[model samples]
Target chain A: MIRIEDLDFSYGRDGFRLTVPKLEVAAGEKVAWIGPSGSGKTTLLNLTAGIVSPDHGRIVVSGEELSALGDARRRDFRVRRIGMVFQEFELLDYLDVLDNILLPYRINDSLTLGPEVIERARALAEGVEIGDKLHRDVQKLSRGEQQRVALCRAVLTGPDVILADEPTGNLDPSNKERVLDILFRYADEHEATLVMVTHDRDLLPRFERVLDFDELCTPAPAPAQEARA
Target chain B: MSDSLYLAWRYMRHHKLKTAILIGSVTLILYLPLALQVLVDRATEQLSARARSTPLIVGARGSAVELALSTLYFESRSPAPIRMAEVERIRATGLAAPIPMHVRFRVRNQRIVGTTLDYFDFRGLRVGRGRPLAKLGECVLGAAAAAALQAGPGDRVNSSSEALFDLAGVYPLRMRVVGVLERTHGPDDEAVFVDIKTAWIIEGLGHGHQDLASVGAEGRVLERKDGRIVANASVVQYTEITAENEDSFHFHGDRSGFPLTAILALPPDDKSKTLLLGRYLGRDETSQVLEPVAVMEELVGTVARVRSWVIAAVVLVTLATALTMVLVFWLSLRLRRRELETMARIGCSRRTVASLVVCEIAVVFAFSVVLAGALTGVTSLYGPSLIRGLIL
Candidate 1:
């Protein structure tokens, strides 16, 4: 469902580059990128979600190369195919939980998902134990509830893949376990690929494969003058 | 689109104070210019209407607008008194009819114009009460004047030379109100009518009062006869109207020395008008004959220029205000980066974001337009009275 080959990105002209030489995830695969803070885990997820373009090489998601698309086309492609979750649970404060879930369908208008799409969203909310908060404003919910709502919104559109950036970062132990369980169960039931960036080591066992920062990043060069002397 | 509008409504509902401030600013920008336009248009209409109605206005030599305003509209300062001889000269020409107007007094704040009965007949004025001013010292009040002073027929009221009290000048003249004129929606509604002779009496020309005492050892005392307060009661003194006093009102000392602001001439034909104009213009050094309609056209032209400039200024100001509001709204959108980003991540398009901002501004503008229209309508309805009150 997604592939990255020799991808490199930087914040500015003088900033250090973040490089991912090669990565791939097959369709319906649930994978996790576990790394320390500032190890470019969120940057990789941002690249996959098409939120930011890479400086070099290709990022192909569902057969569409994101780096080649214009700004408008890239945004359209992202809304249609890629669903993203944030660690901060970035749900629109003004909208209720159901409206937040249905936002993607409203924006594109061509997405002719059936009544079953709404039923699936409601069932996902029940699975995440946020069923009672469906009609409530997102701002009124607690951090864990908000995170679960974000997870529901991410997979509500039945997208090809879901990119969650530390989805359960603020959750307690039991709530974190519940949120991850719901996320993985929905991905498997819908045959949707899941790629999550997280620092929690306990979540490593849930994914089929874990890509650690040391395995993904290129090694730094040693000093050249010491051997010459 | 629906989503954009819904989001816009939510934003406005959330920030009520900011929306109110924006609407108020827009309303003020629109209201002032619209109200000014109404006032200027009505004033121009009234001025032109008066000018078109009066065929000829003869007054002491001065501004034709002032002359027309005074004779036809009863507005502005009193003009220098012209002789009845000018009326005779114009009458002998036989080119057109002539009506003399003597405006010298006021009952309360309303002007009291004393002209011949022909004045009312020429203007087609109708009385609402008893009769016209057919007798000396008898008067007809305008509807507004009657209502303002609460005076009716058979009631006597004191007259002054000004719209308001001028105690240092002449004392008020006592006149009996005999009639009231119907409402004309013009200056006539604010005037009092009387015979020209009464105007002369009010001007200190005809019969009234004279000093009845002489300076004596104890200052002054009324002359006594048989212990009665009789002092030159039957004698003809300065108070009596005589043939000599009548001649004094007629200025023959110098034909050119006559006091007249302007003359309103209604010639029998275009040729006669040209002839009358040619005969008067450049015939004297101190006076000039002017066409009121022509001067009024020129005045309107000047006013149009000023009005265009003001309209342009108002339009520019409105445009600038709209631009400022849009820019402020745009900046506010930029400031809500996190919120908008959240919406964007939830599959909202860039178009939706832009539409939300535009929708919010449109709602504010619509409300402002309605508020401004109501304010302008109210001002237009009462503008004349407000202006008159301010000026008077």
Candidate 2:
């Protein structure tokens, strides 16, 4: 579902640079990327999702070359085919849980928010154990509940690939396990690829394969680590 | 677009105070100038309507504007008093009918208008209740005056004294409210109408006292000679003109020499009006004849000039408020930069994101417009009465 070869990316002049010689993950694969901070794990996710373009490389996700697509088409592909969860649970504070879950349909015209889609979003919220809090403001929820809401948003569109950047980084151990259970369950049910980046090595055993970030990205000429995603 | 509007509405709902503040600022910007215009237009209409109806005003040689104001509105202090002889002079001209006016006293906050019954006929005033001013001390209340004083027929109202400490000031005369005039929505609505003689009595020009020739007058009489009895200050004077003392109330001086504030001269035709106006234009004329319409127009012109200045000032204020509002919105956008970036990264196009912000502003503007329009409509409906209350 994802392939990258000869990927060269940098922040700017004399900044942190990342080089990926070769990487591939098969469809329906559940992979966890274990890395230190600033090891280019999140950067690889962004490139694969077409959120950022590589300076010199080819990126293929779900048989589509992300680097070849224009900005608008790439964005369309990302919303339609890939679901993304962030470390911060980027949900709008003004909206309730349901609106945050249905945000993809509202922000982009590629998807229509029909009654069926609403039903699906409700089902996803219910599956994440947040059905009762659908009308509550996201700010009023605990960190675990907020991450559950983000997971519902990512899976509501039923994308082919789920890219989560440390989705359980802010959760307690119990909430961390709950979030992973939901993420893994959705990927298994839909045969969707799951690429998660995390600092915790204890959670690596659940994935089909684990990739070390240092082995994937060559050492930068300068000593400073990359802070951007 | 509806989606964008929905999100915008949610954002506005979350920040209620900010939304309300924006609406209030915009509403004031739209309402101030509009309300001022409505009030000024109503004032102009009211001033012109009364002035246009009254063809001419004859008064003592002083400010024509003051004479018109006093004669027409019963507002402002009375100008120099013209003699009752001026009404006779206008009558002698054979070109117009004269209605003498005396507006010098007050019954509480209401003005006391002393004129012949012809003034009522000329001004289209009707007695809404009870009877007209038939007796020497009987008075009629205007509709608003009756409401303000809470008096009706058979009720007595004493004129307010000019000065409480001045021993020589006119004594308060208790006059009976014989009737009330129908509301005309003009200056007459706030006046207490009485006969010219009743106003003179209020001024102490006419008075009634005990009969010194009577059998009980022996102690009060200072002299009794040649069939004439002179009384001392101990003799009782009537403060109220009752039926018993009505016959004794008499003027001390010649009636023609009595004071009048102004005369409403009604000419039958344009030729008669021109002749009467020509009669008062002499270089030595002690009294001035003025076309009230002309004087009111001048006053309105001055008000219009001031209106422009006021509107200019409001516009400047509105501009400053608009700039401040823009700054507020710009700062809000800066604060929401992260939210906006999330929307864009989540696949909202630049246009869609911009549309959301625009929708928020549009809703605020729409609410302000509706509020301002409603306020202006209310002002248009009641502005004339408000101006009348203020001016009178």
Candidate 3:
């Protein structure tokens, strides 16, 4: 469940600006954001994950306001309640697939990792067809395999919301279909909401809600007034 | 440890070459000072211990350090050889027991030390195998000397020739090895022990000639021949001393005037040590009676100055190494900036990434310290032998 209202975010002097008066995704809903390149699709996901705070907005992620928490608390919240899949897969090469999947627990002490969690991780890797590569370094894996590993890591924490940026960008057609099946199936089973960014239009029919970023973005805002001495 | 440190360890293990090279740099940087300090301390301790045992050395007037070096270490010979008469006079006082030393020749790079049996007893030298020198030509090998020569009790070594062209210079004495001294871990370990008369024989002060009855024994005797019963071409000089020839080994000069390199004195008590020191204190021209320990302290003082220079050199090397290490590691971290950003983006705090880098450095430092400690232990074990090789 992610809620955004009056979200006004900007990047740089000559960067994309985003505006959303009101946007809400219900629990367990499969939503897709379809837009052109630099249309603020991944930026919206980053804002929702509290990676970068919005300039003028109120964002509620899993019933917690992003503006209410400090920077560290926001990071901890993201680690605990939301899982993100980057477009580049963002896997640490030194660690194997299992450790990358279990990274959330390693960083945040609030999440306890015990034998049951380890078993769940194995099960999740099995679902993603990477069970045999649990101990193999992610750098040795192909792009498709890395994509699957990133998806498994996103859902390994059983977070309330999953945010994916170009999750199926590098997969073949058939592999992409299978990946969507697994992702939606796992999210439905866990009753977690999903928000994915994609450039493909054919993949838009599967999501219950398809939000087009062309309707949500505006022209670049003027630069802020210089701070007086 | 946190997961950040665990990740750091994994990265280091994954990059074995990088880790090994960094650890090697740190280990070498740390080993220099540790090695110098350890070696210097061990040398000081050993020099002081040897000095303690040899309480006094009576030698020709010269540099005290030179006297200490020559007498205690059996290194360079004294510039002016003192007469053995001084040993007799020192003994007549009853204030001390003097052990005469004659070191004038070498056998296979091993110093041939000609001293009395009392020298062995006074120095606490024990034969690990065979017997002590009991005959004129019998010799005892120190542990290292025996090892260097690879000779046992039954073997023999010829004293080195001094003048290769001189036909009548002291002939090489074929001395039989009767025993091998136990490892004393001192200068004795590098010397060959024989009777003082044997040294005189090696010095040409004493010699052996064919007997009058052996003038024509198997035509093997060759010597100078003329007049009534004079030595001739038939009379021969015996190079190897046997039971028959050892009886003829006698000093020909005024025996008291025979040369000795040093006289090691063992005073009975503090009062005797004082009396012996006072007896020869003002008479610095003929001989110098020196407390070996005091002279060694002066020697150590000079060595301490050299050590300070070594320490300064060590500091400069350490700083240069540290600077290179810092530059290399800082550049390495910069190259890993993207990886660190990935870690931060994965919900790890920036502090965690910084801590990871620091933990990696700490691990390398810990490894270097342990490596340096092990190196120090090995050097300490071999310290005395190293000193003997370098100084003696």
Candidate 1 TM-score over all chains jointly:
0.69
Using lDDT, rank the candidates from best to worst: 2, 3, 1
- The positional error of residue B301 in candidate 2, measured at the CA in angstroms, is 1.9
User: Evaluated on chain B only, what is the TM-score of candidate 1?
Assistant: 0.71
Which residues of candidate 3, in runs, are more than 4 Å off?
Answer: A11-17, A172-174, A219-229, B155-158, B162-174, B207-212, B218-252, B278-284, B387-392
- Per-residue error at B130 for model 3, in Å? 3.1
Which one wins on lDDT? 2
**What's the CA error at residue B215 for candidate 2, in Å?**
5.1
On lDDT, the stronger of 1 and 2 is 2
Provide the lDDT at B58 for model 1: 59
lDDT of each residue in A42-142, candidate 3, tens digit only? 77888898888888989998899986678788877887778788778888787899988887777665677788888988999998899999999899998
DockQ of each: 0.30, 0.61, 0.50
* Global Cα lDDT for candidate 1: 0.73
- lDDT score of residue B259 within candidate 1: 36
